[model samples]
Each structure stands twice: as structure tokens, then as C-alpha cells.
Target: MVNKVTVESLTYEQLAKVFDHAILKPEQTTQDVITGCELAKKYDAKSVCVKPCDVKQASDLLSGSRVLVGTVISFPHGNSPTAAKIAEALQTVADGAIELDVVLNIGHLKSGRVQACQDEIKAVIDACHAKNPDVVFKIIFENAYLTKEEIVQACQLSVAAGAHFVKTSTGFASSGATLDDIALMRANVPDHIEVKASGGIKTLDQVVDLLNQGATRCGSSGTDKILDEFKQRRGL
Candidate 1:
């Protein structure tokens, strides 16, 4: 878990580390991935959240840098079969990804199949750990498709399944992370399990606001803009 400090007290590097610069758009190409990794290194962001196919390339590019490589599983939708998700997770870890952002099985969760959802999440995390126990796992809730009660359910299920973090959105959904949802997620989970606010988080103030509200991480594609604004604010 990150240190519990006010956002105002965070220095420029501390603020930059709160962001997981997203490179997961489907239309993005290899060049985009390269550019994204460069941006992550430039700002010393936490990680570059890339698509599954770009995991190896991203890992290679980010190797020896403070920015780690993170990839998504089952992507915007969490409807993939359990076997496939596990396979994808293992492969990404093997390709040198140290962090993973996996989408929860939203359909199963909403259909009241809590046990199945938990089982799948645990199974995926287990497989990844079997390969490398240090690989971090963040469960993406894609909150746009879920109700408040369901979101809480997702948070509980993620914790029960041993997820390291519970995330807000995939950014491909109709809506993205909201302050209300971030606070709600933070309130629902124990302190050990962190909350990540993603999707449409584009400004430094929004990042600061989310951090203040208990989000340990925020995902965005506009990392350069946010970090540049931070430098301007601090006159770095």
C-alpha cells in the first residue's frame, strides 16, 4: 500500500507515480506503444497499461526504467473463458509484465453468481502467482456497467479472491471513473486493498482530487498533459 499522505503534500515525482499511463486503446499501434512507454519514462509514472498483444514490446521498452509494464486481460469486457484468461495472464507475466489489470466477469457478478466470479478471479491470480508470486493483480470493475450494490459486490469479491487492488473502469465504457464511485469503493474495501480510478481521468486536478479521495492509482492516456501541468504548477 502507498503511504497515506495528503495529495497537496506529494511532490512532483510522487504525483507522477500515482498514474498508470494507459496505452490500451484498441486502435493503437506499435508506434503508439513506443511513444506511450517513452511518456511513462518521461514522467516516471507507475506503469504503462497496454493491450495483451503489446506486453512483450512494452516490457522490453520499459526494462531498466522505473516505469513497469502492466497489461489488461479479458480487456474492456470480462466475458473470456476462465482458461483463456489464465493463459493470457501467465503469458503476460512470462513476457516480463510485473503488474496486471484484469477485468472482472461482469456478467457473472450481475447475474448473482458471486461464487463463480470469485472462483474465476482466484483462479487467474493463482495461475499468475504460480508463475511469479510477485506479479501484482488489479481487478477492473468497469463500473459503468454496474449498479452501486453490484460495485460493492465486486469489491468484496475481489478482496475475497485476493486481488491486490480494485479498479474503477476500463475507459472503453460509456462512462469512466467518478469521484463518487472512487469514494464508495474506498469506503467499501479494507485499507490493505487499494482502489484505482481510471477512465476519462485527464487532468492534474482530477488526479489530485482522486488521490485525496483515497484512490492510490489513476489511469490515463494524457499523462504528458497532466505531468506538464504539474511542472507548471510547481514551476519545476
Candidate 2:
């Protein structure tokens, strides 16, 4: 495939745009969220993905900066009730988060409850859109848990439900984002929607490889170290 390690494909400019550092945890304090947002600003990252408890702090810190505030809903597990997921998304947004990553109900999708899965996504999307048209909604399908056909189906459902992006994993599942998954997601999704590759993206090469596979956004805590490595290699 494409060699994305250089400044050519995933350029310094583009590299900065791909980051969405995940700072989701109970032990993480407001200061941690603020520092994460600051780091995003310093590195030119797109956003800092925080948990619900820290969304407000992240939003406040990132307000005047280009770094956006993102929060996860129904989190690492897609087994939560649809109502719970909806409430999480709504409350997180009301808490000042501009971006949301909601886990799709894998049970529904895999059990051939196609309409149920679609409806859940649509309801959440509708709720977010109604709250504020500018709010971004990304649906996480946890690709590692799915077969190839299931992955394609998930992408189609995400697009049909009006999600802004189809994300790979929550980093707490059987697997995280993979090149094969990204390729499948990119090829299956419509051009209007973007692909997000997350989970276990620790090195610079992983980021480059994912981007080359059509991942427009990346979620990881390794952003700073990875970028540092890139800059050092470039003698910048």
C-alpha cells in the first residue's frame, strides 16, 4: 500500500489533524483533562476524548482553541440499553461536549435485529441533531468483534443512520483498529462519512499506516510521544 511514514501522505499538517487523545478514566482529574486539551492544542490535534465526568472541563479548556471536546457514550461495552446510550449522549452533550462516540448495540446487529440497531443509531443521531445541528455524532461498531460481512453491514447501517463517522473499536474489546478493518470500513462507507481507527495506536508508524488505510481520525494517548518521534526523525 501507500508508504505514509514521510511528510508526504500523512504530512505534519495532516498528522496533527488526525489525533483525538483519549483521556477517559475515573482517576483522571479536571487538571488532567485540561492538560490533555492543552496538549491537543500544542500538537494541533483535532480533539481530546474525555469521559463524561470531565467533558465540561475539557470543553471549558478547549473553548478558545481549535481542539474539540469529545466524549464516549455506552462506552467500552455496547451491551447497555438503548435508552441508557441515548441519555449518555444527551447528557454528555449538555455537559458541553461537541463530539460524541456511541457504541452500537452489537447484540442487535449480530442477531439480525437490523432495524433495532439502525433505530438505536438513528434515535441517538436524531437526538444530537435536534439538540444542535452542529454537534458531531460518531457510531462505534467495535470492528474486532465482527466478521468481514458484519463489518460492511455495520458501515452501511452507520451511514443510513446519519452518523458522521464509523469508528473501529473502544480499545476494551477483542481487538482494536486494524488495517484490514480500516480498509473494509473505508470501502464500505460513503465518501461523506469518515473512518476513525482507534485502540493500540502507540507508535508513529501505526498512525501513518491507519491514515493510509483511510482513517481520518485516530484515538490514542500516544499522540505526544508519537509526534515527538516524528519530529526527531525529521530533525525538526
Candidate 3:
């Protein structure tokens, strides 16, 4: 388990390491992606989560930096056919994305087709691992559309599928990550699997609160503002 540290005591680097700076909006332009990568590099963020099409460019821009390039598979909807999602995962890895945040098939899970959902996730994980064994895979739950019990089941499936993390939302959902959800995910998953709180996280306090609740990473577009607030509070 990660040692708990007060928000005020965290250094800028420590705070930055938990962020996966997001650039996944549909309206985001190439320049926006470039700017986002710059911000990720500047902040030394853990990764820059970009749209699938932008993976190659993002990887090039982030070359020589510690920031990893990530992209979404099956994206916000998560309703894509399993074969399609697996193909997308392979293509993204070939495009230089070292991390993938894949949306779970919400429809299948909601319908109690747990085996199908787990199989789909496992397929993508296997494909990615075959190409690059170190590729990080985060399974997005889109918690706004799931019940507490469903969330627990999703976490279990994620671990069974060999996913590296269980994420909260897609940021397009009606709601995003909550402390309660993060805590629930933490309790359910094994120590090898981490929790990532994404969406609706705009403030430093919100990020810190999620971390306190056992979120190891976060996906946010407001990376600049949040880090600035951290710097201000810490007198950096």
C-alpha cells in the first residue's frame, strides 16, 4: 500500500506524478493535442491521455520525456464489438501508445453478462501484452451508469482480465469519480491493480481527496490549474 501523505506535505513532483493529463475531447484540434503534450511535459505528468487518432503525434512530441503516451479504446461509449476494440488496442500500441484506457461494455455489464464483459477486456489485454508486455491497461467503468454492486463486479472482472487499473468515468458521463467509488474500487481490487479517478476533477483539493480515498491516478484536462493551485498552497 502507498503510504498516506497529507496534501499540504506533497511536493509539486509528487502531485504531478499522479496525473494523466487528458486531451480526449471530440472538439480538440491538433494544436490542442500539441499544447496538452507540452503541459504534460512541463508538469512531468505521468501520461497524456489522447484520442486514439492522436497517439502517434503525441508519442513523437513526448519523446525523450518521462511522460507516457496513452489513448482510449472503444472510447466513451464502450459498446464496440470485442474484436473491434481488440484491433483498436493493437493499432494504438503500434502507434506508440504505451498506455490504454479502455471503456468497458456498459451495456453488457448492465445486463449482467459478466462473462462477456470480462472476456472482452481480456481480449484487449492479451492483444496489448502480446505487442508490448509493459503496456499499461486501465479499464474504465463509467461509474455514473453503474450501481455500487456493479462497480465491485467490474473491479473483480478487471483484475481477472489482467488490467492494471480500474477507472471511474469517461468524463462524458453525467457524473464522474467520487470518493465513495474510489474507496469501493480500492477495497475490491488486489494490490497489484490500482484505482484511477477520472472526470469532474478540476481542483487540487478534489485530486487530493481522491488520492486519500485510494486513487493512484487521475485523468483530467485541468492539469494546469490543479497544479498551479498545488504550487500556490505549497508556496513553491
Candidate 4:
């Protein structure tokens, strides 16, 4: 974990490491993905979170770099069958994705299918681990569509399922990551299970604020703007 407890104490490199440069939009073209990968490389981002189809390309582009490749499973909607989700997790890993952000079954959770939800998450993570033990797994709660209690429940489910992180929002929802949501998620999960703030994170301030509030990662498409602002703020 990052030892820099406060945002002011964080260096430019540390701030860059907190970002997972996102390129997950459905309409993004192949060229857009290439440009996004270049941006991630330029910023030394921790990872490039791309769509499933783009996983191989991203992995290939970032092969010699430290920027890892990550892809989403079940995506904006978490309504896929457990078997399909597991297949996607396996395929993405095979395509060189080192991290997987899986969307939780929002309907199941809201409808009180707690055991089913936890079971699916466990099955997917277990299968992915079987393929690659070092592949990181994150559970997306899509908090914009859930109640506070539901968010807490999702956190518990993620922990029970042994997820490495609990994420907020999918960026296709009505709203995205909020400070209140980050704080709430931080309080609900254990120290080992970190929080990730995604969806609508566009500025350096938002990034720093979320990290200070306990989010170890922030997903954003605005890598250039955020990192440029960081340099400007410090006159670098």
C-alpha cells in the first residue's frame, strides 16, 4: 500500500500511479484506443483499463512498460450469467489482462439474492486465479443505482467473495463517484480490501481527494489533463 497518507505529501509519480487510464467506452475506435494507450504510457499510469475486445491490443502495446492491462466483465450491466462472466474473466486474462473489474449483479443484490451474488463473484475470481494467480479482481457496485444499505451489502459480498477491491460507479449511470460514497465504502471494507473510485473522475483535485479518503485507485479518461495540472501546480 502507498505510505503517503496525505494528498499533499504525495509526489507526481505517486499521483500518477493512482490512476487507471480508462478507454472502455463502447463507441471508441481502434485509433482511440491506441491514443489512450500512448497517454497511459506517457503518464506512467498504473494500468490501462480497456474494453474486452481491446485487451490484447492494450497488452501488446504495454508489454514492455509497467502499465498493466485491465478489462471489465459484465460491464455497465451486471446481468450476465455466472458461467459467461467466468468465461470472460478467463479470456481476458488469456488476452493479457492483469486485472479484471467485474460488475456485480445489481438486480440480484437489490432483489436480495445475496448468496447468488457472492457465489458468482467467488466463482469468477476462483476461475481467474486458476488461470493466473497474480490477476487482480475488483467488484463494481455501481453505487449510483443502489441505496446506502445496498452499498454496504455489496462491500460485504465483495469481501466474502475475496475481491481485491470494491469499486464505485460504471460511468454510464446517472451519477458517478462522490466523496460521500468513497467515505462510505472505505468505512465498510477492511484495510486489505481497498476501494476504487471510478466514473466521472476528471480533475487532479478529485483524484487527490478520493485517494486521501481511502481510494487506492481512480479510473479516468482524463489522464493528460490531470497529470498536466499536477505538473503545473508544482511548476514542473
Best by TM-score: 3
List runs of model 1 lying over 4 Å from the truth.
Answer: 1-8
Candidate 2 stretches with Cα past 4 Å from truth are: 1-5, 8-10
State the lDDT of candidate 4 residue by residue for 104-205, as single tens digits: 999999999998999999999999998789999989999999999999999999999989999998889989999999999999999999899999999888
Taking all chains together, the TM-score of candidate 2 against the true structure is 0.94
Clash number for candidate 1? 0
lDDT value, residue 47 of candidate 4:
94
- Model 1, range 1-236, lDDT digits (tens) per residue? 35545435779888888889999877899999999999899889999999989999999998899998999999889999999999999999999888999999999998999989999999999999988999999999999999999999999999999999999999989999998999999999999899999999888888888887789998999989998988887778
Report the poorest 10 consecutive residues by lDDT, candidate 1.
1-10
Weakest 10 consecutive residues, lDDT, candidate 3?
1-10
User: What lDDT does the true structure give each of the candidates?
Assistant: 0.91, 0.85, 0.93, 0.92
1 Cα displacement, candidate 2 (Å): 12
lDDT score at residue 165, model 4, on the 0-100 scale:
98
Task: State candidate 3's TM-score.
Answer: 0.98
Q: Which of candidates 1 and 3 reaches a greater lDDT?
A: 3
Models sorted by lDDT, best on top: 3, 4, 1, 2
TM-score for each prediction? 0.96, 0.94, 0.98, 0.97
User: Clash pairs of candidate 4?
Assistant: none
- RMSD from true fold, candidate 4: 1.5
lDDT per residue (tens digit) for residues 134-209 in model 2: 8898889888778898889889988998899999999887779999999999999888899999888899878878
